[model samples]
Target chain A: SQQGEEDPQALSIQEGENATMNCSYKTSINNLQWYRQNSGRGLVHLILIRSNEREKHSGRLRVTLDTSKKSSSLLITASRAADTASYFCATDHDYKLSFGAGTTVTVRA
Target chain B: GAGVSQSPSNKVTEKGKDVELRCDPISGHTALYWYRQSLGQGLEFLIYFQGNSAPDKSGLPSDRFSAERTGGSVSTLTIQRTQQEDSAVYLCASSLEASSYNEQFFGPGTRLTVL
Candidate 1:
Protein backbone atom coordinates (compact mmCIF):
# COMPACT_ATOMS: atom_id res chain seq x y z
CA SER A 1 0.00 0.00 0.00
CA GLN A 2 1.15 3.56 -0.70
CA GLN A 3 2.09 5.53 2.35
CA GLY A 4 1.50 9.02 1.03
CA GLU A 5 -1.60 10.44 -0.66
CA GLU A 6 -1.87 13.90 -2.12
CA ASP A 7 -5.01 16.00 -2.26
CA PRO A 8 -6.26 17.90 -5.34
CA GLN A 9 -5.42 15.72 -8.32
CA ALA A 10 -4.90 18.77 -10.49
CA LEU A 11 -4.42 22.52 -10.05
CA SER A 12 -4.33 25.45 -12.43
CA ILE A 13 -3.25 29.02 -11.79
CA GLN A 14 -1.70 32.02 -13.48
CA GLU A 15 1.99 32.55 -13.63
CA GLY A 16 2.71 34.78 -10.57
CA GLU A 17 0.05 33.23 -8.43
CA ASN A 18 0.76 31.02 -5.49
CA ALA A 19 0.18 27.27 -5.66
CA THR A 20 -0.14 24.95 -2.74
CA MET A 21 -0.38 21.09 -2.61
CA ASN A 22 -0.98 18.90 0.37
CA CYS A 23 0.06 15.28 1.08
CA SER A 24 -1.06 12.95 3.83
CA TYR A 25 0.68 9.79 4.97
CA LYS A 26 -0.49 6.76 6.89
CA THR A 27 2.65 5.87 8.84
CA SER A 28 5.40 7.52 10.87
CA ILE A 29 8.37 8.64 8.84
CA ASN A 30 11.82 10.01 9.37
CA ASN A 31 11.54 12.66 6.65
CA LEU A 32 9.40 13.85 3.78
CA GLN A 33 10.68 14.92 0.37
CA TRP A 34 9.11 16.67 -2.59
CA TYR A 35 9.86 16.05 -6.26
CA ARG A 36 8.89 17.44 -9.65
CA GLN A 37 8.38 15.48 -12.85
CA ASN A 38 8.08 16.86 -16.34
CA SER A 39 6.03 14.80 -18.73
CA GLY A 40 7.31 11.20 -18.94
CA ARG A 41 10.68 11.97 -17.42
CA GLY A 42 12.00 10.91 -14.06
CA LEU A 43 11.35 12.91 -10.92
CA VAL A 44 13.65 15.69 -9.79
CA HIS A 45 14.30 16.15 -6.13
CA LEU A 46 12.99 19.49 -4.93
CA ILE A 47 13.19 19.66 -1.14
CA LEU A 48 13.34 17.46 1.91
CA ILE A 49 11.99 18.23 5.41
CA ARG A 50 12.92 16.19 8.43
CA SER A 51 10.29 15.09 10.90
CA ASN A 52 11.86 17.26 13.59
CA GLU A 53 11.61 20.31 11.38
CA ARG A 54 8.29 22.04 10.91
CA GLU A 55 9.09 24.16 7.88
CA LYS A 56 11.75 24.58 5.20
CA HIS A 57 12.40 27.03 2.42
CA SER A 58 14.28 26.87 -0.86
CA GLY A 59 14.20 29.78 -3.22
CA ARG A 60 10.48 30.51 -3.65
CA LEU A 61 9.44 27.05 -2.50
CA ARG A 62 8.18 26.51 1.03
CA VAL A 63 7.36 23.15 2.66
CA THR A 64 5.60 22.58 5.94
CA LEU A 65 5.33 19.32 7.82
CA ASP A 66 3.07 18.39 10.72
CA THR A 67 4.00 15.08 12.29
CA SER A 68 0.92 15.03 14.43
CA LYS A 69 -1.23 15.23 11.36
CA LYS A 70 1.08 12.98 9.34
CA SER A 71 0.79 15.46 6.54
CA SER A 72 2.89 17.93 4.56
CA SER A 73 2.27 20.79 2.20
CA LEU A 74 4.41 22.26 -0.57
CA LEU A 75 3.91 25.89 -1.51
CA ILE A 76 5.28 27.49 -4.63
CA THR A 77 5.03 31.24 -4.54
CA ALA A 78 4.92 33.39 -7.64
CA SER A 79 4.72 30.41 -9.92
CA ARG A 80 6.15 30.36 -13.38
CA ALA A 81 5.45 28.45 -16.55
CA ALA A 82 8.59 26.45 -15.85
CA ASP A 83 7.04 25.32 -12.58
CA THR A 84 4.22 23.58 -14.40
CA ALA A 85 4.72 19.91 -13.71
CA SER A 86 3.61 17.01 -11.56
CA TYR A 87 4.58 17.37 -7.90
CA PHE A 88 4.83 14.39 -5.58
CA CYS A 89 5.50 13.94 -1.90
CA ALA A 90 7.58 10.94 -0.77
CA THR A 91 7.88 9.59 2.72
CA ASP A 92 10.97 7.77 3.92
CA HIS A 93 10.41 4.75 6.07
CA ASP A 94 13.15 2.20 6.85
CA TYR A 95 15.26 3.38 3.92
CA LYS A 96 12.45 2.97 1.44
CA LEU A 97 10.44 5.75 -0.17
CA SER A 98 6.69 5.64 -0.76
CA PHE A 99 5.29 8.33 -3.03
CA GLY A 100 1.89 9.94 -3.35
CA ALA A 101 -0.25 9.91 -6.50
CA GLY A 102 0.95 13.51 -7.07
CA THR A 103 -0.68 16.81 -7.97
CA THR A 104 -0.47 18.15 -11.50
CA VAL A 105 0.06 21.92 -11.63
CA THR A 106 -0.47 24.03 -14.69
CA VAL A 107 0.80 27.59 -14.79
CA ARG A 108 -0.63 29.69 -17.57
CA ALA A 109 1.70 32.39 -18.70
CA GLY B 1 30.50 14.11 -14.53
CA ALA B 2 26.96 15.35 -13.94
CA GLY B 3 24.00 13.38 -12.55
CA VAL B 4 22.40 9.96 -12.72
CA SER B 5 21.85 8.62 -16.22
CA GLN B 6 19.70 5.89 -17.79
CA SER B 7 20.15 4.26 -21.16
CA PRO B 8 17.71 3.31 -23.90
CA SER B 9 15.70 6.45 -23.14
CA ASN B 10 12.78 4.76 -24.85
CA LYS B 11 12.08 1.08 -25.46
CA VAL B 12 9.27 -0.57 -27.33
CA THR B 13 9.04 -4.35 -27.26
CA GLU B 14 6.39 -6.82 -28.25
CA LYS B 15 4.66 -8.90 -25.68
CA GLY B 16 6.53 -12.12 -24.70
CA LYS B 17 9.86 -10.44 -25.48
CA ASP B 18 12.43 -9.44 -22.88
CA VAL B 19 13.78 -5.96 -22.12
CA GLU B 20 16.75 -4.57 -20.26
CA LEU B 21 17.12 -1.09 -18.76
CA ARG B 22 20.38 0.34 -17.57
CA CYS B 23 21.23 3.00 -15.01
CA ASP B 24 24.50 4.68 -14.00
CA PRO B 25 24.74 6.37 -10.65
CA ILE B 26 26.82 9.35 -9.68
CA SER B 27 30.32 8.80 -8.41
CA GLY B 28 30.64 7.75 -4.80
CA HIS B 29 26.92 7.17 -4.36
CA THR B 30 26.33 4.25 -2.01
CA ALA B 31 22.64 3.80 -2.38
CA LEU B 32 20.84 2.91 -5.62
CA TYR B 33 17.14 2.40 -6.19
CA TRP B 34 14.77 1.34 -8.97
CA TYR B 35 11.13 2.34 -9.32
CA ARG B 36 8.27 1.92 -11.76
CA GLN B 37 5.62 4.50 -12.64
CA SER B 38 2.54 3.63 -14.64
CA LEU B 39 0.21 6.13 -16.15
CA GLY B 40 -1.90 7.91 -13.55
CA GLN B 41 0.01 6.19 -10.76
CA GLY B 42 2.71 7.24 -8.35
CA LEU B 43 6.24 5.87 -8.32
CA GLU B 44 6.43 2.35 -6.96
CA PHE B 45 9.55 1.02 -5.29
CA LEU B 46 11.14 -1.98 -7.03
CA ILE B 47 14.51 -2.59 -5.46
CA TYR B 48 17.33 -1.08 -3.43
CA PHE B 49 21.09 -1.68 -3.42
CA GLN B 50 23.45 -0.57 -0.67
CA GLY B 51 27.19 -0.98 -0.88
CA ASN B 52 28.37 -4.61 -0.94
CA SER B 53 25.37 -5.85 0.95
CA ALA B 54 22.63 -7.91 -0.61
CA PRO B 55 20.02 -5.92 -2.45
CA ASP B 56 16.48 -5.53 -1.17
CA LYS B 57 14.19 -7.07 -3.76
CA SER B 58 11.14 -7.08 -1.57
CA GLY B 59 9.39 -4.50 -3.73
CA LEU B 60 9.48 -6.59 -6.87
CA PRO B 61 5.94 -7.44 -7.85
CA SER B 62 6.72 -10.78 -9.46
CA ASP B 63 9.45 -13.23 -10.32
CA ARG B 64 9.76 -11.86 -13.84
CA PHE B 65 11.24 -8.61 -12.55
CA SER B 66 14.91 -8.81 -11.62
CA ALA B 67 17.75 -6.35 -11.20
CA GLU B 68 21.46 -6.44 -10.58
CA ARG B 69 24.17 -3.94 -9.69
CA THR B 70 27.66 -4.72 -10.83
CA GLY B 71 30.84 -3.05 -9.50
CA GLY B 72 28.50 -1.03 -7.30
CA SER B 73 28.08 1.51 -10.06
CA VAL B 74 25.94 0.46 -12.98
CA SER B 75 22.62 -1.33 -12.51
CA THR B 76 20.41 -3.25 -14.85
CA LEU B 77 16.76 -4.23 -14.63
CA THR B 78 15.58 -7.11 -16.75
CA ILE B 79 12.05 -8.18 -17.35
CA GLN B 80 11.59 -11.61 -18.84
CA ARG B 81 8.65 -12.43 -21.09
CA THR B 82 7.26 -8.95 -20.88
CA GLN B 83 3.54 -8.39 -20.87
CA GLN B 84 1.44 -5.44 -21.90
CA GLU B 85 0.81 -4.61 -18.28
CA ASP B 86 4.55 -4.03 -17.88
CA SER B 87 4.37 -0.87 -19.92
CA ALA B 88 5.55 2.05 -17.82
CA VAL B 89 8.51 4.29 -17.11
CA TYR B 90 11.40 2.63 -15.31
CA LEU B 91 13.22 5.12 -13.09
CA CYS B 92 16.58 4.85 -11.36
CA ALA B 93 17.90 7.01 -8.54
CA SER B 94 21.01 7.13 -6.42
CA SER B 95 21.76 8.86 -3.16
CA LEU B 96 24.89 9.62 -1.21
CA GLU B 97 23.83 7.11 1.39
CA ALA B 98 20.88 5.13 2.65
CA SER B 99 20.14 7.63 5.38
CA SER B 100 16.68 9.13 5.53
CA TYR B 101 17.93 12.68 4.97
CA ASN B 102 19.94 12.02 1.83
CA GLU B 103 18.26 13.23 -1.34
CA GLN B 104 18.07 10.85 -4.29
CA PHE B 105 19.16 12.08 -7.71
CA PHE B 106 17.10 10.53 -10.50
CA GLY B 107 17.91 9.64 -14.05
CA PRO B 108 15.84 10.67 -17.04
CA GLY B 109 14.26 7.21 -16.99
CA THR B 110 13.63 4.55 -19.63
CA ARG B 111 10.12 4.57 -20.98
CA LEU B 112 9.03 1.04 -21.86
CA THR B 113 6.03 0.14 -23.96
CA VAL B 114 5.16 -3.53 -24.27
CA LEU B 115 2.69 -4.09 -27.05
Candidate 2:
Protein backbone atom coordinates (compact mmCIF):
# COMPACT_ATOMS: atom_id res chain seq x y z
CA SER A 1 0.00 0.00 0.00
CA GLN A 2 1.14 3.57 -0.67
CA GLN A 3 1.81 5.90 2.23
CA GLY A 4 0.75 9.16 0.59
CA GLU A 5 -2.20 10.28 -1.55
CA GLU A 6 -2.43 13.51 -3.55
CA ASP A 7 -5.58 15.50 -4.19
CA PRO A 8 -6.78 17.12 -7.46
CA GLN A 9 -5.18 14.56 -9.72
CA ALA A 10 -4.87 17.15 -12.48
CA LEU A 11 -4.83 20.91 -12.87
CA SER A 12 -4.47 23.47 -15.66
CA ILE A 13 -3.86 27.18 -15.45
CA GLN A 14 -2.53 30.14 -17.39
CA GLU A 15 1.21 30.61 -17.45
CA GLY A 16 1.25 33.48 -15.02
CA GLU A 17 -1.21 32.04 -12.49
CA ASN A 18 -0.28 30.21 -9.35
CA ALA A 19 -0.94 26.53 -8.69
CA THR A 20 -1.47 24.69 -5.44
CA MET A 21 -1.32 20.94 -4.80
CA ASN A 22 -2.02 19.03 -1.64
CA CYS A 23 -0.83 15.74 -0.19
CA SER A 24 -1.97 13.67 2.72
CA TYR A 25 -0.22 10.74 4.32
CA LYS A 26 -1.27 8.03 6.76
CA THR A 27 1.72 7.63 9.11
CA SER A 28 4.26 9.57 11.07
CA ILE A 29 7.16 10.94 9.06
CA ASN A 30 10.44 12.70 9.61
CA ASN A 31 10.17 14.71 6.39
CA LEU A 32 8.08 15.22 3.26
CA GLN A 33 9.65 15.95 -0.12
CA TRP A 34 8.28 17.11 -3.46
CA TYR A 35 9.39 16.05 -6.91
CA ARG A 36 8.61 16.97 -10.51
CA GLN A 37 8.57 14.67 -13.52
CA ASN A 38 8.32 15.64 -17.14
CA SER A 39 6.60 13.32 -19.56
CA GLY A 40 8.66 10.21 -20.24
CA ARG A 41 11.33 11.12 -17.70
CA GLY A 42 12.48 10.36 -14.19
CA LEU A 43 11.58 12.46 -11.17
CA VAL A 44 13.56 15.54 -10.17
CA HIS A 45 13.85 16.62 -6.55
CA LEU A 46 12.18 19.94 -5.73
CA ILE A 47 11.99 20.80 -2.05
CA LEU A 48 11.82 19.11 1.33
CA ILE A 49 10.04 20.16 4.50
CA ARG A 50 10.91 18.56 7.82
CA SER A 51 8.31 17.47 10.31
CA ASN A 52 9.59 20.00 12.81
CA GLU A 53 9.23 22.88 10.36
CA ARG A 54 6.06 24.57 9.22
CA GLU A 55 7.08 26.05 5.88
CA LYS A 56 10.02 26.42 3.53
CA HIS A 57 10.61 28.50 0.44
CA SER A 58 12.88 28.35 -2.60
CA GLY A 59 12.59 30.70 -5.52
CA ARG A 60 9.00 30.43 -6.82
CA LEU A 61 8.15 27.32 -4.81
CA ARG A 62 6.67 27.22 -1.34
CA VAL A 63 5.92 24.12 0.75
CA THR A 64 4.01 23.87 4.00
CA LEU A 65 3.80 20.92 6.33
CA ASP A 66 1.37 20.28 9.15
CA THR A 67 2.28 17.20 11.13
CA SER A 68 -0.83 17.40 13.26
CA LYS A 69 -2.94 16.90 10.17
CA LYS A 70 -0.47 14.64 8.44
CA SER A 71 -0.83 16.75 5.35
CA SER A 72 1.26 19.06 3.17
CA SER A 73 0.78 21.54 0.33
CA LEU A 74 2.98 22.83 -2.50
CA LEU A 75 2.54 26.19 -4.19
CA ILE A 76 4.21 27.19 -7.41
CA THR A 77 4.13 30.92 -7.95
CA ALA A 78 3.88 32.66 -11.33
CA SER A 79 3.94 29.40 -13.17
CA ARG A 80 5.33 28.97 -16.68
CA ALA A 81 4.79 26.49 -19.46
CA ALA A 82 8.01 24.81 -18.49
CA ASP A 83 6.46 24.16 -15.12
CA THR A 84 4.16 21.66 -16.73
CA ALA A 85 4.87 18.32 -15.17
CA SER A 86 3.59 15.65 -12.83
CA TYR A 87 4.27 16.49 -9.21
CA PHE A 88 4.58 13.94 -6.43
CA CYS A 89 4.88 14.06 -2.68
CA ALA A 90 7.00 11.55 -0.80
CA THR A 91 7.05 10.82 2.89
CA ASP A 92 10.08 9.46 4.72
CA HIS A 93 9.23 6.87 7.29
CA ASP A 94 11.31 4.22 9.01
CA TYR A 95 14.20 4.88 6.60
CA LYS A 96 12.13 4.28 3.42
CA LEU A 97 10.36 6.93 1.41
CA SER A 98 6.91 6.20 0.01
CA PHE A 99 5.54 8.30 -2.88
CA GLY A 100 2.03 9.43 -3.71
CA ALA A 101 0.15 8.87 -6.96
CA GLY A 102 0.96 12.47 -8.00
CA THR A 103 -0.68 15.60 -9.42
CA THR A 104 -0.35 16.56 -13.05
CA VAL A 105 -0.19 20.31 -13.62
CA THR A 106 -0.26 22.00 -16.98
CA VAL A 107 0.73 25.59 -17.40
CA ARG A 108 -0.93 26.86 -20.56
CA ALA A 109 0.43 29.75 -22.63
CA GLY B 1 30.31 15.37 -8.08
CA ALA B 2 28.36 13.09 -10.35
CA GLY B 3 24.91 11.97 -9.24
CA VAL B 4 23.50 8.48 -9.13
CA SER B 5 23.42 6.90 -12.60
CA GLN B 6 21.56 4.01 -14.25
CA SER B 7 22.70 2.14 -17.34
CA PRO B 8 20.93 1.39 -20.62
CA SER B 9 18.56 4.30 -20.09
CA ASN B 10 16.14 2.28 -22.19
CA LYS B 11 15.72 -1.49 -22.62
CA VAL B 12 13.20 -3.50 -24.60
CA THR B 13 12.97 -7.26 -24.14
CA GLU B 14 10.62 -9.89 -25.42
CA LYS B 15 8.31 -11.75 -23.11
CA GLY B 16 9.73 -14.84 -21.38
CA LYS B 17 13.27 -13.47 -21.81
CA ASP B 18 15.45 -12.35 -18.94
CA VAL B 19 16.59 -8.77 -18.39
CA GLU B 20 19.18 -7.16 -16.18
CA LEU B 21 19.17 -3.51 -15.04
CA ARG B 22 22.09 -1.74 -13.44
CA CYS B 23 22.48 1.20 -11.12
CA ASP B 24 25.56 3.07 -9.89
CA PRO B 25 25.12 5.19 -6.82
CA ILE B 26 27.03 8.34 -6.00
CA SER B 27 30.47 7.94 -4.54
CA GLY B 28 30.47 7.28 -0.77
CA HIS B 29 26.71 6.81 -0.58
CA THR B 30 25.81 3.85 1.61
CA ALA B 31 22.06 3.62 1.10
CA LEU B 32 20.67 2.38 -2.21
CA TYR B 33 17.02 1.83 -3.16
CA TRP B 34 15.11 0.44 -6.13
CA TYR B 35 11.55 1.34 -7.17
CA ARG B 36 9.18 0.57 -10.03
CA GLN B 37 6.76 3.07 -11.57
CA SER B 38 4.02 1.92 -13.87
CA LEU B 39 2.26 4.32 -16.20
CA GLY B 40 0.18 6.74 -14.20
CA GLN B 41 0.97 4.83 -10.99
CA GLY B 42 2.93 5.79 -7.94
CA LEU B 43 6.38 4.42 -7.21
CA GLU B 44 6.38 0.92 -5.75
CA PHE B 45 9.22 -0.02 -3.46
CA LEU B 46 11.22 -2.94 -4.86
CA ILE B 47 14.32 -3.36 -2.71
CA TYR B 48 16.84 -1.49 -0.56
CA PHE B 49 20.50 -1.85 0.37
CA GLN B 50 22.54 -0.12 3.03
CA GLY B 51 26.29 -0.61 3.25
CA ASN B 52 27.07 -4.35 3.65
CA SER B 53 23.97 -5.18 5.68
CA ALA B 54 21.56 -7.76 4.28
CA PRO B 55 19.51 -6.19 1.46
CA ASP B 56 15.79 -5.76 2.01
CA LYS B 57 13.83 -7.96 -0.37
CA SER B 58 10.51 -7.63 1.36
CA GLY B 59 9.03 -5.33 -1.32
CA LEU B 60 9.71 -7.69 -4.20
CA PRO B 61 6.39 -8.59 -5.84
CA SER B 62 7.40 -12.13 -6.74
CA ASP B 63 10.21 -14.61 -6.78
CA ARG B 64 11.19 -13.64 -10.31
CA PHE B 65 12.34 -10.23 -9.17
CA SER B 66 15.72 -10.09 -7.45
CA ALA B 67 18.45 -7.53 -6.82
CA GLU B 68 21.95 -7.42 -5.37
CA ARG B 69 24.46 -4.81 -4.29
CA THR B 70 28.15 -5.66 -4.54
CA GLY B 71 30.95 -3.79 -2.71
CA GLY B 72 28.19 -1.58 -1.32
CA SER B 73 28.39 0.60 -4.46
CA VAL B 74 26.90 -0.79 -7.65
CA SER B 75 23.53 -2.56 -7.64
CA THR B 76 21.78 -4.79 -10.13
CA LEU B 77 18.10 -5.67 -10.52
CA THR B 78 17.29 -8.80 -12.44
CA ILE B 79 13.93 -10.03 -13.63
CA GLN B 80 13.52 -13.59 -14.83
CA ARG B 81 10.75 -14.73 -17.18
CA THR B 82 9.67 -11.23 -18.02
CA GLN B 83 5.96 -10.43 -18.11
CA GLN B 84 3.97 -7.60 -19.65
CA GLU B 85 3.06 -6.32 -16.23
CA ASP B 86 6.74 -5.89 -15.50
CA SER B 87 7.03 -3.02 -17.99
CA ALA B 88 7.82 0.16 -16.16
CA VAL B 89 10.57 2.64 -15.34
CA TYR B 90 13.02 1.22 -12.82
CA LEU B 91 14.42 3.99 -10.62
CA CYS B 92 17.54 3.93 -8.44
CA ALA B 93 18.26 6.22 -5.55
CA SER B 94 21.06 6.68 -3.03
CA SER B 95 21.54 8.74 0.07
CA LEU B 96 24.54 9.74 2.12
CA GLU B 97 22.94 7.92 5.01
CA ALA B 98 19.78 6.08 5.94
CA SER B 99 18.72 8.68 8.42
CA SER B 100 15.05 9.60 8.30
CA TYR B 101 15.80 13.16 7.21
CA ASN B 102 18.33 12.38 4.52
CA GLU B 103 17.02 13.06 1.03
CA GLN B 104 17.48 10.39 -1.66
CA PHE B 105 19.12 11.44 -4.94
CA PHE B 106 17.61 9.62 -7.92
CA GLY B 107 19.19 8.30 -11.08
CA PRO B 108 17.85 8.98 -14.56
CA GLY B 109 16.22 5.52 -14.38
CA THR B 110 16.22 2.47 -16.63
CA ARG B 111 13.06 2.24 -18.69
CA LEU B 112 12.24 -1.45 -19.10
CA THR B 113 9.67 -2.65 -21.59
CA VAL B 114 8.63 -6.31 -21.39
CA LEU B 115 6.85 -7.27 -24.56
In terms of TM-score, the best-performing candidate is 1
Q: How much lDDT does each candidate structure score?
A: 0.93, 0.91
Q: lDDT by residue for model 2 over A35-79, one digit each (tens)? A: 999985677889988889999999999999999999999999999
Clashing pairs in 1: none
- Model 2 chain A lDDT-worst window of ten: A39-48
Runs of candidate 1 exceeding 4 Å displacement: none
Tens digit of per-residue lDDT, candidate 1, span B46-87: 999999999999899899999999999999999999999899
Q: Judging by DockQ against the true structure, name the best candidate.
A: 1
Each candidate's interface RMSD, rounded to one decimal?
1.2, 1.4
Give the lowest summed-lDDT range of ten residues in model 2 chain B: B38-47
Model 2 per-residue lDDT tens digits across residues B1-115: 9999999899999999999999999999999999989875669888899888888887899999999998889999999999999999999999998886678889999999987
